[model samples]
Target: MTTALTQQLVDLPVIEVLYSDLDNTLLGPEGSLLTGPDGRPSARAAVALVDAAVGGLTVVPVSGRAMPQLRNDARLLGLSDAIGEVGAVILRDGRTQYEWGECPGGIARNPHDTLTATGAVDAVLDAFPGELRPYEPWHRGREGGHLFHGVADVDAANDALAAAGCGWACLRDNGRTGGWEGRSVRAYHLLPRGVGKAPAVADDLAARGLRPEQAAAIGDSVEDLTMAPQVGAFFMVANGHDAPGTIRTPGGMGEGFADAVLALLAHRAGATRDNRQAPAPAEGTVVPSTVLVVEDDEMVADVIRISLTAEGYDVAHVTNTAAALSTIQASPPDLVLLDIMLPEVEGWEVLTQVRSQPHTAHIPVVIMTARTMPADEVRGYNLGASAFMRKPFTPDELLAQVDGVLQDTPRA
Candidate 1:
């Protein structure tokens, strides 16, 4: 009930994956994925998803909902994996990667059924009268955990369930739900002892060969906050109030999710300014071409990727000049977007090397930079730069330059 913000963070790991809680975290009002918190239809959430995908980051939605609900949500969200049933079931690439349960007596039984059979669900329900009730309609067809929604002293009820010969199952406060008693109430889950979002996330990270520093999680519940320890960064939506030791976002629901995603992407893009959507690509056949982006700044590289990838260009990025030259020699892309200020070597020298090489000489180079000296332009042209672009160019300019250069190049 108290809003206590987490202390701010100074340094963060380059996040490779994002674990998000659904239902009021990623999805906005009334479970509408595209709606903003202000109750108007908006595509900010959808665009954020595309930004993460184009930026080459994995997005996994974690929820207490069952497999069926998660399946539908994944289909609509253009995702292939989801963690459902509060971590009891995990589906990746359309197959069950990890499914947790307490199968007793050599029979496969779900936690919800076991809890019901052991009268644990009833014990918790009886302990809290009008304050707790079965979350019906949506609660049916669940295979991992049963849902309950209401306000109750969860600790006292969990103690009562343990004393009633149903210690195997306990109540988990799943954060806020719709109204009960004319005010907001929290959703609860009755799952087996070990099935929880945090453990499953930790185990999933290990299976992916990822360190705790490589992943981040965002959600709007205390249960979701448990993931803070397992991830490189953990963020809470403003609507979730506050918990200590977590980063708080400015927005709530889908808006919060979008903001957090962009922040993470910016960090990965070497801390470029947060990106916004580029102009939609023209409706026409797109020529598939691979464009190598040579920029140390992560955010700008990400924006370029979004713009080009939208037009069906395969984007490859390298943070330094060495990787750029190496990739060009190994497998020359159709075009190279080079930045003048690099870590070790300058972009003009790279262009000179490309021109001198017999095999890579044909590849087009576009010098993109913030420097606007007349001498720099002369140097770029002398080094055989095909096109020189200034920094802070619009998406239209980027698309036109690439399209024009690619069209001029001969293809066998």
Candidate 2:
């Protein structure tokens, strides 16, 4: 299934602000901060963020890192603003400009005193003994949240915090704890009950006179999920933990996931503006083209449904090959969007079956799947597929291909 991230991006929301988590979401698998030859963040990602910012999208770093680390990242990425310390601190123009509640900011400060939080940190350390060690930033009095490394068991640590009667909540560092060459000692953050990335992000948006629907968030861990409800859309990097209704990027370990998203947004924005100026369709046009989508992923199906519907096409989606065949037999659609990866009854077999049948043989079929090898594309075309689209396609590209195929094929 297509992920929630894909659906939202495909629908082309006007995202004025983008909140990106650092660590695994923007950094390389080896934690490299250097841009690639293309001057983009990673090898696979495009350098569209610069264009996005130039086009007026505010790209802000929202991470759990301390102020110093956040500043370094902002410098490297050419970003000017960030929310650090797990939402306790905010930086603007390379300076620590605001502290959630302590400073003049829209977000209310956590009512719990830092002293009380320090006590909770002490309790957890004492309970876990040698197992839990404070991260270096904590010793420097980083505000917003206290971080610790060497957590062997997150649940047990949370239990210890609860038993100590500490109101602070324990959040596992999902970003730093996973993927290639990941940290061996898992990290956890202890924050006041009401403090999170979401509230801090909300404050930033409000300060800029923007609403939640005008922003989007990208993160690679569970902590990032806290901000999901506060934004128009949330993107989970490929290496991050899975969450329902989040857009999933194909790139992982900061390998251009952010860049890809920015590129899609920029493309969509341009398309929308051009569409606005383009001539309208003739009056009383014939029924819009009907498309049959054969894919198992509901998220992907939804993306196709929304995109095709917006372009004035009727779309019918089926999850399996059996249903696809039944629908075609009952009422053949103008075109078929087939995916090779099906639960059972592979799409190639379906293609072959359709081609051998006289009634359905004339219908055009498009192959849209993650299997993008040359051999796969060749095999699909050999089986009479009309067009081939790789996974992670933009809405504009999908529509263009559909239009091309329809224009080439003679209507019966």
lDDT scores in order: 0.78, 0.69
Candidate 2: tens digits of C-alpha lDDT, residues 283-359: 54333469999988664566567667667789999989999999998998899999999996799987998899999
Which of the numbered candidates is closest to the native, going by highest lDDT?
Answer: 1
For candidate 2, give the lDDT of residue 288: 42
Q: Residue-wise lDDT of candidate 1 within 1-412, one digit each (tens)?
A: 1112111322555578899999889999888998988889976678778768866679999988878888888889988889988897788767774444442323336555667777787898899887888887667878777788988887887798789876666688877778456878898887877778898898889888899988999999878888889998898988885787777877789988876777676565432222444445445524647999999866567667755775667999998878888998898888899998999887777788888998989888999987879999998888898988886565567878998777676753
Which residue pairs collide, candidate 1? Answer: 269-298, 269-299, 270-298
> What stretches of model 1 exceed 4 Å from their correct place?
1-13, 97-107, 128-131, 175-186, 243-245, 271-412
Best by TM-score: 1
Error of 1 at 34 (Å): 1.5
